[model samples]
Target: MEYMVNLEQFYGPMDLLLYLIEKNEMNIYDISIALITDQYMDYIRATEHIDLDQLGEFLVMASYLLNLKSKMLLPDPVEPSEADQESPDPREELVNKLVDYKRFKLAAELLGERLSDDYPRIFYRHGSTVLPEPESELSATPRSLHRVYVRLLQDMLAQDKYQIPQGDINVGEKMSEIEHKLKLAGRPVHFLELCHRDLGRREILALFLALLELIRLGKVTALQEKRFGEIRMVIKC
Candidate 1:
């Protein structure tokens, strides 16, 4: 039997930096690339069968590190310019980025912890084993399974009252724009047709997630014209 390797699990340099910084528990206020670079190289060596096309960016960053390391090694014959003296340290900039990204991640984690404490697993009313109701009252109309899914979503949003972060702005706006365009056209839009418009992986991912959110909110419905035909989305009635 032969073993197969999956290189897809390794995220790039930033992922590596996040791991190191977290492992060390050192303040992002102080970062040493000299230390980071050595560990980065060790990680690279350990990774086998990395696709060249995918690995290109990491390789470029590694080459950059080597160049910077070489520059740091060269003995200075003359003092660096006054500008260089005033300028920020490259290591410091990297540290600052790690710090900022970490803050958002920390923010989400904190919110998650708050959620656990704030909401009861189940609320008790004047009954035996009652589930909590939505913050908003739902309609008593009949619904399909899909419609029920959306109603459940509307209920969750009402109960939880999600406050969309500024970072979440782009995706929401794009999704709304998509909804508007579909509405104007007055027809169901093919999912692929909607997905193709210049959304990079992140934005595209955001749109998909937003659609799911909308589906949960009873704001959209999906339809399939044929067995293998494209799926279409229309505003839920």
Candidate 2:
């Protein structure tokens, strides 16, 4: 069985740090080291399901922040050391950069919100192509697992700097790929079971996207046979 996962769900540490600084309206050059560190920790704690490899630069920054906080806590030397005069605050440069980035982020988000008034979603047809709708139209389209996956893809793409051509991983192709490999191994597993295999989160997400495409095209049926654990997927008749 080929296990897959997607790692695109999370943002890097710099992006996260800028968000904290902007929300607090703090000066970039003169950050309240204590406050920013606390906020960063909150975000780290909030991201509960992080795959260690996908953690991004945030983990590095987190270590830096903690180190800075620790140094600040130590008692001053009994006598001033010569190094004290030559040394500078290690955090000064990072604070300035984060502050500048925060300004740009705020402007972009404001511009985006002002121009868009709709939400986005995907809809799968029983025997045809899945239609997509912006957030403005979700109330009219029924929600299904297929639709949920599409929206997740849409949201991820939207975070990109430029509008790249939309490319879809076909569900039918993925179904064929899975089945052939399964036949080689002689076993069948639940849809979620496939999601749990040992692969990167990003790869797993890509597989789900491909699976939805196949479902939309009437190539497969993803069904749950038991309350939990087992799932059965088969080529559609």
Candidate 3:
């Protein structure tokens, strides 16, 4: 009676051979080539509507198994006493190939499971239809008007363009000084108050950068009460 086997159940010839070996409770190291070859051929014959490409692979394994069986049946040649090592078994190469294939197949299955588990779920958001509010116009304050006038006067006076030699300003030192002043006052300080008349252009720039760094570090907060008004610096609560 011809046994019906599903071709889909086995990946290739080696897979079918492995299944047959395990089913018969045979040791992998000492597989019975005759029994395995017979079963392998049986499975190939039983499989229905088999693809010609896939059938060729099974036929190749069948030929190798037959060749190995023929070699095992051949007589062994006499060895000299000095070379007392036993002759290598003909099945060793095939066994190693099967072992490696089985290991790789198991690993592939594990990876497939992991890929399924880690598959990402996609979510889409709907677009909004409401119109955005119009931006309000900024009106200049009296303090802002005064600051503009002072800046213009300074620009007019700076026409002479004289270069003054000054040492590099340490932003870190300026930051420490500002933090100390804020702690001493225990209240908000005016931005202009930090800019003294004696301070050179680089010194003023350093102070501004230090203030910005403090704000970025969340150690201080800068607030303007009105548009173009004086910016006040206070310690962050």
Which candidate should be chosen as best, given TM-score against the real structure? 3
TM-score, predicted candidate 1 vs. hidden true structure = 0.38
- What count of clashes does model 1 give? 0
Q: Candidate 1: lDDT of 211?
A: 77
- lDDT by residue (92-113, candidate 3, tens digit) is 9999998998899899997777
Using Cα atoms with residue i matched to residue i, what is each candidate's TM-score against the true structure?
Answer: 0.38, 0.36, 0.47
Q: Which 10 residues in a row give candidate 1 its minimum summed lDDT? A: 1-10
Candidate 3 residue runs with Cα over 4 Å from true position? 78-83, 117-237
Q: Provide the overall lDDT of each model, using Cα atoms, as 2-decimal numbers.
A: 0.70, 0.67, 0.86
The runs of at least 3 residues in candidate 1 whose Cα sits more than 4 Å from the true structure, single-residue gaps closed, are 1-11, 51-54, 75-87, 108-237
- RMSD each, Å: 20.1, 22.1, 23.2
Candidate topping lDDT? 3
TM-score preference between candidates 1 and 2, better one: 1
Task: Summarize candidate 2's per-residue lDDT along 22-93 as a digit string, tens digits.
Answer: 679977777777899997777776665677876756678888888888776776454576655755676777
Return the clash pairs for model 3, or none: none
lDDT of 1 by residue, 1-237 (tens): 143434356566666667776677766777555776776676676667888886786677677777666655666545666546554555665666777877877887877885575755555575554456756965555557679889999999887766443354476886787778678878888777777765556777777777777778889887787998887889865
